[model samples]
Target: MKYLVTGTAGFIGFHVALYLLNRGESVVGVDNINDYYDVNLKYQRLAECGIDRGNVSDNKKAVSSKYPEYSFYKMDLADKAVLMDIFEKEKIDVVINLAAQAGVRYSLTNPDAYITANIQSFLNILEACRAYPVKHLVYASSSSVYGANTKMPFSTSDNIDHPVSLYAATKKSNELMAHTYSHLFNIPTTGLRFFTVYGPWGRPDMALFLFIQAIEKGQPIQVFNHGKMKRDFTYIDDIVEGIIRVADRPAKPNPEWTGQDPDPGSSYAPFKVYNIGNSQPVELMDYIGALEKAMGKEAIKNMLPLQPGDVPSTYADVTDLKRDTGYQPQTSVEDGVAKFVAWYKKSYGK
Candidate 1:
C-alpha cells in the first residue's frame, strides 16, 4: 500500500519511514524541517533515506538516491494548498501524521506554535483526508493528554478532561477532531497516544537524550520532580511496529457501543484511541542511573521541584494495543540506553 508519512525528518518519523521502506512499500514523506531541534540532524536523517541535502528546498519533491520506491518533500501540514497538491499527485492510501511542535515546557512561552502546528495543521490533514478518501489515517497523539489525572497505568477508557498544559490540550483536541471526522465522513481514524518514546535517532529534546548529554560532559543534570517522576519509555522500533500494526487495521466501530454510556476512547464511528507504550514505568533516578551505567560516567545532579505543566508520573495501560495489534514493547531501559549511547558515541564520533 502507498503511504504518506508527515514529519519524515523528525526522530520517530525517520524511523517509521525507514521501516516502511525496508518492508518494500512505497512511501511519500513530508516535513517542514523547522529548527525546533538541529536542522543538520534532520538533514542527516533524510540523507540516510538517500535524499540529498542540497536537492531539497521547500515544497519540492526530492527522489531518494537509494530507494526508488521512496520520495520526500519539504512541506508543512498547515499549508493546505500544498498538502492538497501532494494528495492529488500521490493518491495516498494511508497517512501517518507525526508532525508537531513537541515540547511541554516550550509550550508555556509559545502557545501559538502549539496551536499552529498541532491544531491548525491537524485540521488540514483531516480535511485533506475528507477530500481524498483513504483506507486509514493514523495520527500521533501523546501521553501528555493524560495530564492532571492521577490514575495509574493510564487507560484509554479514562476521561482526560483536565489537561495541565496547552500541548496536552492540543493532543486531546486532535482525538476529538478525529472522532468528528470519523463519525461524519465515515473515515477510519486511529490516534496513537505515545508514551515517552526514545531510542537511536531520538529527539535531542527528550529526557534520555538530555541526561546522556549532560553526563557525558560531566555537567550537573537537573533532576525534575526531585527524581520522583516516572515515565513509560518505549523504544523507537517498538513504537514504529505499533504504528504499522494499528494502521494496517483501519479503525472499526465498537459493536457494543451505546450513546447513553459512551466511551471516550471509542464511538459508534470508525474511530479509536490506544496508548502505545512499554507498559513499564521507570523512575527518573533509575533512568538516570541507567544512562550513567551505559555511558560509564557519573552525573552531577541538581534536584528540582516538578515544574508546572509537568506530571509526576506516566504509566500506560497498553492492554487494548496488545489485544488488537499483538504489540509488546521488548526493549528494557538498560538495553535501550546502551544502544542509544552507542549510537550517540558513533553519531558524534565521541
Candidate 2:
C-alpha cells in the first residue's frame, strides 16, 4: 500500500518516511521546506532520504536514490489544488499528516503562521482525503492540548477545551476537524497526541536539541520553569513505531459510544485519538544531567520563569494506545540523550 507522509522535512516526518522506505513500503513525502528553524537541516534531511536539494521544487516529485519506493515533493499543504493533484495522481491509500507550525513559543509571536500552516493546511488535507478516500488518516496531535489541567498522566478522554498556546489550540482544532470529517465523510481518522519526542535528527528548536547544543558549545542553557518543568520525553523511534502501528489499524466506531455521555477520544463515527508517550515524566534538570553525561560537558545554566503559553509539566497516559495498538515506548532519557549526542557529534563534527 502507498502512503503519503506529510512534513518529510521535519524530524518525525523524516523518520517515519525513512522507516517505511526501509521496510520496502511505497512512500511519498511532502513538505513546504519552511524556514521555521534552519532550512539547511531540512535540506540535509531530504538529502539523507536521497532527494537532492537541487532537484526539489514546488509540486515536483523527486524519487529517492537510496530507496526505490520513496519519493518526495516540496509543496505546501495550504495549496489545495496542488495537494489535490497529488491525491488524485498517487492514489494514496493512507496519509500520515505530521506537518504543522510547530513550537509553543513561536506561535505566540506568529499566530498567522499557525493559522496558515496548521489550520489551513489541515483543512486542505481533509478535503483531499474526502475527494479521494483513504483507508486510514493518522495525524499528529500534542500533549500541550492538556492545558491548565493539573491532571497527572493526561488521558485521551479528558476534555481538551482549553489550550494555552496557539500551537496547542491548532492541534486541538485538527482533532475536532478530523472528527467532523470522520462523521460526515465516513473517513477513518486517528490522532496521536505526541509528548516531548526527542532522539537523533531531532528538531533544533526542541528543548533536547537546544540544551545539547548549548552544553556542547559551553553556553548557558535556558531552564524553563526554573528547572521544575517535566516532560514525558519519548524517543523518536518509539513515536515512529506507534505511528506505524496506529496507521495500520484503521479507526472503528466505538460500539459502546453514547451521545448522552460523549467520549472525547472516540466516537460512534470511525474516529479515535490516542496518547503516544513514554508514560514517564522526567524533570528538566534531570534531562539536562543526561545530556551532560552523554556529552561529557557541563552546561552553564540560566534559570527562567515559566514563559507564557508554557506548561509546567506533561505526562501521557498511554493505556488506550497500548490496549489498541500494543504500543510501548522503550527509551529512557539517558539512552535517548546518548543516541542524540552521538548523532549530533557525527553530523556536526563537534
Candidate 3:
C-alpha cells in the first residue's frame, strides 16, 4: 500500500518511513523540519533516509537517493491546500500522522505552538483523510493524556478528561476530533497513545537524551520528583512495529460498544485507541543507573521536586493492542539504553 507518513524528519516518523522503505513499500514523507530542536539532527535523519538536506524545500517533492519506492516533501500539516494536493497526487492508501509540537514542559511556556501544531495540523490531516478516503489513519497520541489520574496501568478505556498540560489537552483533542470524522465520514481512525518512547535518534528534549548530554559534560542531571518517578519507556522500534501493525488493520465498529455506558477508547463508528507501551514500568533511579552502566560513567544527579504539568508516573495497559495485533514490546530498558548510548557516542564522536 502507498503510505503518507508525516513528520518524516522527527524521531518516530523517520524510523517509520525508513522501515516502510526497507520492506518495499511506497512511502511519501512530509515534515516542516522546524528548528524546534537541532535542525541538524533532523537533517541527519532525513539524510539517513536518503533525502538530501540540500534538496529539501517547502512543498516540493525530493525522491530518496537510496530507496526508489520512497519520496519526501518538506511541508507543514497546517497547510490544507498543499496537503490535499499531495493526497490527490500520491493516492495514499494509509496515512500515519506523527507530526506535532512534542513537549509537555514546552507547552507550558508556549501554548500557541501546541494549538497550531497539534490541533490545527491534526484537523487538516482529518480533512485530507476524509477527502481522500484512505484505508487506515493511524496517528500519534500520548500517555500524557492520562494526566491527573492516579490509576495504575493507564488504560485506553479510562476517562482522560483531566489533562494537566496543554500538550496533553491537544493530544486528547486529536482523539476526539478523529472520533468525529470516524463517525461522520466512516474514516477508519486508530489513535496510538505512545508511552515514553526512547532510543537512537530520539528527540533532544526527551529525558534520556537530556540525561546523556548532561552526564557527558559532567553537569548534574535533574531528577524530578526526587528521582522517585516511574515511566513505561517503550523503545522506538517497538513503537514503529506497533504503528505498522495497527495501520495494517483498519478500525472497525466495536460490536460491544454501546451509548448507554460509553467506552472512551472505542465507538460504534470505525474508531479505536490503544496504548502502545512496554507493560513494565521502570523506576527513574533504575533508568539512570542503566544509562550510567551503558555509558561506563556515573552521573551527577540533582534531585528536584516534580515540575508543573509533570506527572509522577505513567504505566500503560496495552491489552487491546496485544489482543488485536499480537503486539509486544521486546526491548528491556537496560538493553535499549545501551544501544542508545552506543549510537550517541558514535554519532557525537565522544
Candidate 4:
C-alpha cells in the first residue's frame, strides 16, 4: 500500500519512511521543513533517503534518486488548497500524520504556533482524509496528555481530560477530533501516544540532544525537576517498528464497547488509541548518567525546579498495543543513549 508519511524530514518520519521504502512499499513524504529545530538536520534526513536538496522546491514532489519508491514534498499541512491537491493527485492509501509544532516549554510562549500547526493542521489532515478516503489514518499523540494524573503506568483506559500544557491540550484535542471524524465519517483513525522518543537523528530541542550538546561543549546542562523526573524513553527504531505494525492493521469497531462503560482506547466507531512507549520509566538523573557513560564525559549539572506545563514523570501502559499488535519496545536507556551519542559525534564531527 502507498503511504503518505508527513513530517518525512523529521526524526521519526524519516525513519518510518525509510523503513517502508526499504520494505519495497511506495512512500510519499511531506514536510514544511520549518526552523522549529535545525533546518540543516532536517535537510540531512531527507538527503539520507536520497532526496537531493537542490531538486526540492516548495509544494513540488521530488523522488529519491536511490530509492525510486520514495517521494517527498516540502509542504505545510495547514495549507488546505495545496494539501488537497496532493491528496487528489497522489492516490494515497494510508496517511501517517507526524507533523506538528513539538516542544512543551516552547508552547508556553508561542501559543499561536500550536494552534496553527497542531490544531489547524491536524484538522486539515482529517478533512483531506475524509475527502480523499484512505484505508487508515495513524497520527501522533503524546504521553503529555496524561497530565495531572499521578498514576504509575499511564494507560489508555484512563481519562485524558486534563492537560497541563497547550501542547498537550492540542494533542488531546487531536484525539477528540479524530474520534469525531471516525464516528461521523467511519474513518479508521488510530492515535499513537508517543513517550520520550530518543535515538540517532533525534530532535535537537529534546532533552537528550540538549544534554549531549552541553556535555560535549563542557557547559553545564540544566537538570529539570532537580533530576527527580522519570520518563519512558523509547528508541526511534523501536517506535518506527511499532508504527508500521499498527498502521498495517486498521482500527475496527469494538463490539464489547458500550456507553454504560466506554473504553478510552477503542470504541464502537473505527477508532483506537495506543501508547507507543518503552513501558520502562527511568529517572532523569539515571538518563543523564547513561549519557555521561556513553560520551565518556560527566556533565556539569545545574539542578532546577520543574517548569510549568511539565509533568514530573511519565510511564506508558502499552498493554493494548502489545495485545493487539505484539508490540514490544526493547531498547534500554543506556544502549539508546550510546547509539544517540555515537550518531551525534558522527553528525557533528566531534
TM-scores, all candidates, are 0.99, 0.99, 0.99, 0.99
Q: Any runs in candidate 3 off by more than 4 Å, and if so which?
A: none
Model 4 worst lDDT run, 10 consecutive residues: 208-217
Q: After superposition, how far is residue 29 of candidate 1 from its true place, in Å?
A: 0.4
| Model 2, runs deviating above 4 Å | none
Q: Per-residue CA lDDT of candidate 1, range 1-350, in tens? A: 89999999999999999999999999999999998898999999999999999999789999999899899999989999999999999999999999999999999999999999999999999999999999999999999999899979899999899999999999999999999999999999999999998989889988878888887788889998999999998889899999999989999999888999888898899999999999999998888888889888899999999999999999999998999999988899889989999999999888
User: Ten residues in a row with the worst lDDT in model 2?
Assistant: 209-218
For all candidates, what are the clash counts? 0, 0, 0, 0
Full-model lDDT for every candidate: 0.94, 0.94, 0.95, 0.95
lDDT of 3: 0.95
The sequence of per-residue lDDT tens digits that candidate 4 reaches over residues 196-313 is 9999999999999899889888999999999999999999989999999999999999999999999999899999999999999999999999998998899999999999999999
After best superposition, candidate 2 residue 248: deviation in angstroms?
0.4
